[model samples]
Target: MTETGESGGRKYDPAATHNFPDERLNAILPDLLSDPEITTYLEAQNVNAVTRKGYNDHGTKHVEIVRNRALNLYDLLKGGDVGFNGAIDQDLDEADEPVIIALAATLHDIGHVVHRDEHVYYSIPLAADLLDRLLPEFGFYDASEAVRMKAEVLHAILCHHTEEDPLTTEAGVIRVADALDMERGRSRIPYEKGGRGINTLSSQAIESVSLRPGDGSPVLVEIEMVNAAGVYQVDNLLKAKLDGSGLENHIRIVAVNTKAEDRLVERIEL
Candidate 1:
């Protein structure tokens, strides 16, 4: 999918709703995926995290999931007729919204390349440098507009973790999307190698997470779990990210445990 998007404009994979529906995203996707610098940082982050620290997946896979969900959340909000324009304050066009989201989500954790302890801080400078190089490829915006977009994207990356209050709707979207990557396959590499840590346990409990338009809100996040333990991923982790995400009023979250328990955790005691 990334290969196709990189090669032929932004031809997204024909998965459920995975395509870049926004025209702005369609323009930016090809440049983003094809950037060797961006790809290097994405891969390097995982080396420090998954290899050295034994953390869950934090490379291309994790970023891809976050980028997809962030844009999907953006779509849901826009589809619900919410008029809050993330680009308005900066005097940019609304078409700039998805560009901010896609860049922020893709590079938010690249700071992990420096160290996982404060990867968010590390990501800002790295992302800024890459943005300076890549923004020219978008073409629709002027140099001044590109500068403002860079600031917005950096803000979203800065606020994606640690419960920082996100000032823009785009930043909030990135925060929530980061937390949404807590499903099973995300931690599979670590768990399969005999990791029984809490991160692995919680992710393993989550059978699936589906996001869609909500009945009452703009977005609905439905989490299906095989064991009650998955609640920790939501209650402690997702809740923390969502607390200051600025999407509190726009999104709904629901988690349910299936009656069918997988043998991985059929019987357990804390």
Candidate 2:
């Protein structure tokens, strides 16, 4: 974590990914994050998401948060005895699941480097290009395996947005994990810049979110809210992503206000 890589009051932390149990993921992450090509893409994306649109982070900080949450969610589901495999694609070895998740989460928003409008569609070609250059560098995947991995990663990126449906559990996990970066820190850019849109206001209301094993479900998403207004984030955005994420039945979402609800701005924008 460096002071320069932070934005919107959020600091990028690669520590959790280092703790991931997957040897392939652990080996690949340090190289992938430091790759000049990938770093360039993340910077360009912020130009669009932050400088262009005043949106929450979609750069290194955002990706790191999603990567951590995606892996943690995968771990909770696996530990809770869920039947779904992270590598839901039949051709992929079960061992490659975390690699798929980390890769997809890392590259998913690079398409934002192209444009924020339908960035999901733009991400496909860029990710495919990077996969070509990086997968071979790992010296692990043969040509055939590398091609299959490309399809899997592209699928996850496309499906992270609601426009596409996720066919694999891995894609679904990426979709849901993308939305989990909704704490107040993510709203600092918009809020500090004098933006009071609903997106920023609701996100600012979120204090923290945690994932753990659940008694009734494979995973529990417990959200701590500073005010009731944050419910809009859970019910409107998160619930939509979760509904089609295939892990819907396996995960439970609950939000609670830790204090008396404060008055949120009434002037709202979506």
Candidate 3:
């Protein structure tokens, strides 16, 4: 059921295997994705489309994208000795960092099952319950450790909304990764079906996002756009997310207009 392919010239696979630093996370991700509550939440977005208004998918695919990006950012920052707070800096094992980030990213949007507006607040309790049930399966039999992990993951999930600031490295990674999901496909359905205006137009202009280790920084985020409009997604949305993320200083972001010989429109560094 897993296959690798290119998306906007970048390699991606919906079923890609991520080697989590934590063996517990690696063993549990597949089961978590298949959990009835999680699957139903994702499906509810599309099934109740008429009630929700035209919106980009807030489903499993979106979770996968954010999960991958969050994990990649976490690994890059941790390897560079970027200081992280919350559970990462506390008594938790180093391997637990990726677990926290991945769980936060994966479950961040499930709150949409309640409603989209201010769903971040709703995600907290839902995510906490899921974590409580799932962590024990990952061998987190210690009550204190389970509570710490749930608290950290919920913080990251809560901070993903623009109104909240990420207080930890893992939360920052989740915030930025959530913003990075602004590629065209994300907005295509809404855009095609009368979802007019700046949000849709700007999102459609984005062609791809490529993340890699930077030559001069800990991480590089390269955004490719077909038109100047994509600037809104990068400058307004992504920038806001990164501004509050703790990783700002360790990361550099560049947005290029591919249709214009790769002209750089925005370059930001902390």
User: How would you encode candidate 1's per-residue C-alpha lDDT over 89-159 as one tens digit per residue?
Assistant: 89988778888988999999998988988888999999999888788877877899989999999999999
lDDT string, candidate 3, 142-254, tens digits: 88898888888998999998788888888898998888888887887787778887888989888878777788888888887888788889889998888877777888888
The estimated TM-scores of all candidates read: 0.88, 0.88, 0.87
Alpha carbon deviation, residue 37, candidate 1 (Å)? 1.5
Against the unseen true structure, what C-alpha lDDT does each candidate score?
Answer: 0.80, 0.80, 0.76
Q: Write the per-residue lDDT of candidate 2 for residues 1-270, one digit (tens) a residue.
A: 222323222233445433334667768878987999898888889998898899988897888788878878777776776655545555767658878888999999988877899999999999998999999898779998998888888899999999888988889999999998898879898789998998899998888777777878878887877886787888899988988888888988888777654545322211
TM-score for predicted model 2 compared with the true structure: 0.88
Overall local distance difference test of candidate 1: 0.80
Error of 2 at 176 (Å): 0.3
Clashes of 2: 0
By TM-score: ranked, best first: 2, 1, 3
Instruction: Kindly give the stretch of ten consecutive residues in candidate 1 with the minimal lDDT sum.
Output: 2-11
Q: Who is ahead in lDDT, 2 or 3?
A: 2
